[model samples]
Target: MRPYNFSAGPAVLPESVLRTAQQDMLDYNGTGFSVMEMSHRSDMFHSILYHAEQDLRQLLAIPSNYKVLFLQGGASAHFTQIALNFANGFKRIDSVVTGNWSGIAHSQMGKLSDVKVHLAAHGGDLYHYNDLPPASQWDISPDSAFVHYVINETVHGLQYRDIPQLGKDAPPVICDMSSEILSRRINVADFGVIYAGAQKNVGPSGATIVIIREDLLGRCSERVPNVWNYQKHIEKDGMYNTPATYPIYMAGLVFRWLQTQGGVAQMEKINTLKAQTLYDAIDGSGGFYRNPIQPQARSYMNVIFTTGDKTLDERFIEQAAVRGLMFLRGYPVLGGMRASIYNAMPLAGVEALVAFMAGFQRRYG
Candidate 1:
């Protein structure tokens, strides 16, 4: 049997998408060349790119005013791109530090001498990963370029349940939804830019999706590189440079696969069920397993818990691997176990993990 892979990312992809890619390895759509072998500028490749964007738009209900750019850099690079693009005129960029990803972005923004960064709302030193600070307390400045926030923190297993209310006349919200984008529905209008690293839920590494409001494109200063300029990429239809062709093609396949599964609403329902089942297993373990994240803030896609003993945690991971469940190890920072159940992870996989958890607890408890 194929093992259930729970690596944070470059994670699981849809089985059907993999099978389709395998079938198309030699010839795609009756063309004598594989998608990877075809020229990026070819009419056939153009169609592929076009349909992919359109399908994604339909799935997310992205507004006509928003531009979706499939860029080359990973999500981490966006921490700099966002500031470089939007922090030119504004005195400050307000960022909410909820967990690891947002904290990194906030720290990066602070290093830009031209841009003053405001920590609008932070989980603080004590409660950094357990819960999100209330948005009402955020000190977002109206004149700030953007109020950046992370929708999900992969390592900490924390997530925001709804769009944050950052107060009236607040700057446009920028979100790093890298880990949770398509797992649920989100209002595109609520954000000035919504960016995600494609490795989780989308397709794979090397491609990042950036959906930005039209007006935000040309806000970059002259110091920003041409390749890093959102306006330049927009003018070029996200093809200014040689794009990650295979990753984008795979993303298109993943998006099409999402359509067949009844879209994001269905995905949200299934994802919620999976998280709840796994969390329930942890909660019901009678202290054998403990998830540090608060109930409301817990991520539906990544579940982190521990048996509270490092040696036993090691044992659980080893035994689970032996049972064909793989990459159950936790992030070094978190120091526990994590089961990252992205969109491609079916409920059956979660059930299998829950069963494993129960059996492990019985043996080790």
Candidate 2:
């Protein structure tokens, strides 16, 4: 049996998706060409892209006003591209720093000479990001271009349970949902732009999915390159340049798998059960295992916990790997444990991890 993977990104994929990819590796749809070798402009690849978008739309119930673009450069590249695209005329962009990714995005936006990066809200101190500041406390600038926030902070294991209700007059909300996009249901119209790297929940590392309102398409800065511009991508149907064909195709398969499993609503139910099971293990460990994030903001995707001893933590990771529960180590910046239970992670995988955690705690507690 394959080991359960809990790595953050380039992470676990559904086993069925893997099997399908394996079967089609050398000859996709009897074309005698691997998807990796197929031309992005080919009719076969176009069908792959078309079905991927349509299935995703159907799964999310995405509004007609939104344009879904499959682009490359990962979510990091879009950090700069987002500023260039939407922050063109405005002098300031509001960013809420809840974890490492958002902090990086805020810093990247600050590198731009024209716009100011406003600190809208933060989880906690620089060293410990254990709690989310309520949206009511966010000091949003009224004249800012848009409000950018991460729906789920992968490293810190913090999540916003509900969408932030910024008043009607507030600027558009742009979100980076790299870790938890399709795992839950979100209204597409709630935000001006929603972008996620495909690695975590979608499929693989190369493709980045951007769902943007049609009106926001016209805001791309003239200085931005055609490849990085959203409007240019939308014009070509997300093919302004050669796209990440293999990853997109893989993502297409995952989308179909989601539909067969009864779609995002069903996935959310399973994901909730998995998260609650793991969190229950940690919380019920009698202080042997501890997760510092507040209960309300704890993530349903990434669950972070530590045994409070570095030696014990290392030993736990080592033994978990030996037992076929892999990648239980936390992010380097925050040293402990993080089990990223993305959509592809089955409940059985989570239950195995929980069993391992209980065994480790009993041995060392």
Candidate 3:
């Protein structure tokens, strides 16, 4: 049996996708060439890339006004790219500092360019994730090209629950949907840019999907490097640099699989149930286990909780691993145990996790 994998990113992929890749590893489409070995410019690879983009557009209901680009450098690169590529000579951009990812992203943008961030929750000591910082307090300017927020925070298991309707005058919104890309439906037209590191819910590492409004592509400062420029990326079809072909291909496969499963809306329903199962188990455990996030902001993908005792937390992780549940540990910044139930993690996996947690609590409570 394949052990249940619960690592945060480079996370679990659908078994169906994996098996298909393995079968096609040596020969792809009877072309006598492996997908990894095919030239990116070749029609074969072009077809692969084209289909992937189409499937993603269909899966997300991406508007025709958006340009989907498969690019390199993961989400980290986009952190810098967003500032340099979209700020249009404006020194500062808007940020909503929510959790670890958002913190790192906003901090980078601030250092590299003139960036302004309104901290949404400072470590969220009160309710794990209380309501986000009220929108009125943030400094907003029309010249500030865009606002940014991470849709789902992997480490803290916190989410916005709903996209913040920044004030009417607020700049366009940008989101890092790395950990929760396809787990729920999103209105693509509502945001200026949506980028995701295709590791968690999409496929493997190395690929990042960037969707930017068509008109917003050329607004970057002229000082921006060609490689990071949104205009260049869109013009070259995300091929301005050698792309992460395999990761993009796998992402395409995953998109197709998601479509087969009835796309984002259906996945959202399944994800809701999975998160509820695990959260309910923890909630009903009489304080044996606890999630820190506010109920309203709790993440549907990353479900993080604390055991209250350090030693006990260690015990639970070690014990959980022994039982074939792996990578339950949380991010280093936020310690405890975290269960990242991304798109590929089925309800069965969550059920197993919940049952084991209940059994462990009974013994250790």
Report, for all candidates in order, the number of backbone clashes. Answer: 0, 0, 2
The lowest-lDDT stretch of 10 consecutive residues in candidate 1 is 120-129
Off by over 4 Å in 3: 114-131, 134-137
What tens digits encode model 1's per-residue C-alpha lDDT throughout 1-365? 57898989989998999999999989999997899898889898888889989999999999999999899889988998899898887789988998888889998875654888888888856486698776787888788999999988898898887668765698989999999988999889988999999999999898999999988876866677889888888888888988998899999999999999999999999999999999999999888899878898899888999999999999989999998889989999878799999999988888988888888877767
Q: Per lDDT, what order, best first?
A: 2, 1, 3
Instruction: Report the Cα lDDT for candidate 1.
Output: 0.89
Which 10 successive residues of model 2 have the least lDDT summed?
Answer: 122-131
| Best-matching candidate per lDDT | 2
Model 1 regions more than 4 Å off: 110-113
Runs of candidate 2 with Cα error greater than 4 angstroms are 126-128
Model 2's lDDT to the true fold?
Answer: 0.91
- What lDDT would each prediction earn against the true structure? 0.89, 0.91, 0.84
